[model samples]
Target: MSPPDTDLLHSLSAELSERLKDLLDQALLGMIRPNSASQFAQHAPELENFREAITHSDAKDDMDFLRNFREFVPTTNYEPYRPYIAKFFATPCKESDVKNMFAPGLPYCLAVSSMTSGKSAKTFPTYRPAPHLLHHPLYLSFPHSEGSTLSPSSLGLWQVLTVECEDGQSSKVLPVCAVTVGFQRMQMNWEVEHDKDRIDLWVPGKTDPFAISLVKSYRAFFILNALFALSDRRVATIRFLFASVFVNFLQYVEEEWPLLVDCIEKGIIPDMENVDHVRESLEKHFTANPLRAAELREIGPPGIQGWAVRVWPDLKMFIGITGGSSAASVPKVTHVLGPSVTMQAPCYGSSECFIGLPYYNGDPNTDFKVLPVDGVIEFLDVHSDEPFERVLSAWELVGGGHYEPVLTTRSGLWRYRIGDVVTVKGFAPDDGLPVINYLHRRNGGLEMAFGVTACTESQLTNAIVSASKRSIGQIIDFTIVGDERDTPITYGYLVEIGGEVGEDAKMAIEQTFEDLMANNEFRVAFWQGRARKPTIRLVKKGTFTEYRRQKCDKTNISMGQVKVPIILSDSTSKEWFLQRVIMEL
Candidate 1:
């Protein structure tokens, strides 16, 4: 039956089962060597220190390193994921011994992000990679079938935590900020006021060290006002929730991560040991006592994931806007449209620059595909323009041959760095259109299978929201994020109801949304029997705005920002939720 194109799980499994055979076939073909004269050509793009790597993977044999992933890439790796790198129980990216921490083969050390910790977020990768980092090309695409499984050692968002006790010594947690959304871009100059008091969305660029630091740190914080585009490419539904546009990294690790949103909303924090002691601890805390309010935060994002598009309705508005963050375990419905769903894993990127990978499908755990040949990638010195590692003139091999990615794209970059590591296998005849695919940085984030796993928060949002018949202004604000590790589900929260929703109304709305998301039988079963519909919480007037105002400590204006859900991994998060969602109300 067309190889079960609609069923992501089955497609991935079936394809991976044959991965062994696929690889063998490719290896045999690789036995043939390419002509030497045609092998070492150069199209040096006025760069440096990366001439050799550019052609390192050139088809040594006729196919060992083919121009296509589908041809050479076995559905499965011959060997199990055996990382010979370092293993950090508590310290994922950081360790007492950085050298002994990261393993090879797969990956033991995850690439970290600078997530929003109460204090400093980044601590690991103590060593700074010189700017332009180069990785594979397939790191950008999110095909249709992936989402089978994840490795036990898979690292979520990288985080580094530290507390200054006015002492000489120190302790730390390497918490990373999700590559997509966080306090960074959300920091706006627009502030609303309540009479004499000013509500702060983006702290005034005038004072506040935090605000000043954020403003000074990243010169450009691009805010995209993305709406869901339905089947007909119509804006079916509309809401506003976009903290980041890079939901790529958060897409890995699970399939139906959306279900977590229902569980959290229903106050179901069942013990999940996805990460050994860490997940076990989270389970205990989440299921412990009063499930009332939960303290749920992210190591980073998936923690505070981002958007599918760019554009804000009234970006530079008159007042304070609500905050947007996927900081909740329940995940947030940043914005949902009729059949508008997207997933993106933001890892596979370099701190020095932003190179990334998208999901294989709208769900997490999907195999990833590289970006289009129209894109280019390049590695650079962390602080300078010197080319460091490799270079990808991938545009050259588009449909011509597959190779590692290294270039500078039009996506605001110079000696642009692509964040991923890969060895080209072969090309994929994607619907008669071929594209290159490759592996990514291991030990740092989620693992992968065959058949193209993928995710794009923006795309997902677009699918749902686009399908919605609601007007653009109906959904004031919202955010959507991956919730767990076991399944590829999603969770969302709509701050404004647009109208009242009683039992029947809620059911109708929920069912409508389910129809949009769970179109197939597998998804329908999960929602009807297992997957609970998204929880629609109607915040009392300015409850969220008030909460933000109190936290801001600077103003009391209302800015309608769609934040990611509260991620409750421990008692701390649960308790915080209790105080916020249960107690205050």
Candidate 2:
């Protein structure tokens, strides 16, 4: 029943050829996308300047064929992270130390320690506002086990509906990450009513091809990382060699010809399985009541499928998705203008820096501009022994830039270090302002966030210390993990036991957190909009180390490289309760 070895080789060759052909086509399209660009200029005012950039290349770069097929960049605001340098509080700011800092009309930032959600979120508006109730869970969706599988929510800022179905009904809708599709299956959810000239937002599951195929290619990158890191020495070496060769081939595809990535490209093949994690995850969450999605009794008063949300009344199942970096159906924001948008992927910040965000002219379909506030960014030599933070002694309410932002807002911030690396992309032509890009997160600043300004581990530690009366010795250590992203309840963290605290003591600690956070001013300012209580788990000794090891192994990262690990997982983070380590994994 097995295919012959010759046939398998032939099949792979054909697949490779097909992939190559598609890449070539996309590349051609990207280069000559003049017609599309020409048409867009009339509608979007922001593109007025870029029109020259669009037509700058008379001939294809040929080199950028694959990396940037069709010369099209889906308007995004991802750039390098900003490094933190909160220098105002060289010493921890006590309540009194900051009491006189506030004046009328001055922004009173309530920075809290990130130990417990109540303290961190309740202490800041960004962490616990109404929007946060929708976005916080997203911080919990991507598991280290799952490679780059994110809900489409993070793409909410740039959602564009570009498809139409047979039925003659259509309206702009946000992406799945922003709101639920009400359909049990993502496939059905993508079925949109038709519109005459409007772009459709109802993207079918991966089956429809186009962007899905491009997403599928990402799996290869993930596999490459895994193969490169395999425990087997010889095998890993061989895989690396093969990967190097493939990289050359891929480079050829990117540089010479670029159109093949799209499923819609001529001769492009289907590879739906590679990019269906978002839909599949949704299914796993709702398979118990599969029929719940079939509430479209056409004659009935707008059934469940008619709304963005649906309920399986009998099973008491409520289905929704947390938005992140997935490619899925969403609405078009052609009319919103650009100021409201922020890029998702390359948010600017690092360990010593904490206040950088993405730049979208506020437009969802364009490149981002990085703008760091005076106190948001800082710089350090690559060989520095410790972070030498740079900051302004006072606040600059009016934005000014060029230097890496070194922030010390009301959040009780001192000379805190953010770790984002950056390069000056350019000065904004429109405003003559500086723009930045978010590189990867620096090695030492990563940590769990319940949407609380992406709170840091040390901040959380301080909060826990402030909340608990027990000595630090009683609590050896704790790890904060982001839980489910699209639920009534948001995040949960597990604590590894060190001291003699038992259930009674732990209960007392939880009460302490609730009492202090509920009453704290910073907590009130930050986490006022959230509703769920953060779940805390007390674990056995050494459990924390084991977790760190597994996490390190999973991420292919060395221990001590990153100070804290943020669990951006939607599934396991939400479901798995604490497992007592009778034995370590």
Q: RMSD of candidate 1 to the true fold?
A: 19.9
The per-prediction CA RMSD against the true structure, in angstroms, equals 19.9, 24.5
Candidate 1, lDDT over the whole model: 0.26
Worst 10 residues of 1 by lDDT: 223-232
Tell me the tens digit of each residue's lDDT in model 1 across 41-150: 12113222223333565644444333332222211110111121123333333333332221111111133333222222222222221123222232211112221111
The worst-scoring run of ten residues by lDDT in candidate 2 lies at 325-334
Q: How high is the CA lDDT of each candidate model?
A: 0.26, 0.28
Question: TM-scores, in order shown?
Answer: 0.30, 0.26
- Give the candidate number with the greatest lDDT: 2
lDDT of 1 at 483: 33
**Cα lDDT for residue 379, model 2?**
35
Model 2 bad stretches (over 4 Å):
1-461, 468-473, 481-491, 502-504, 507-512, 515-534, 562-570, 573-577, 581-585
What is the per-residue lDDT of model 2 for residues 197-253, given as tens digits with 9 covering 90 to 100?
Answer: 212222321112122212223323222222111111111001111111222222322
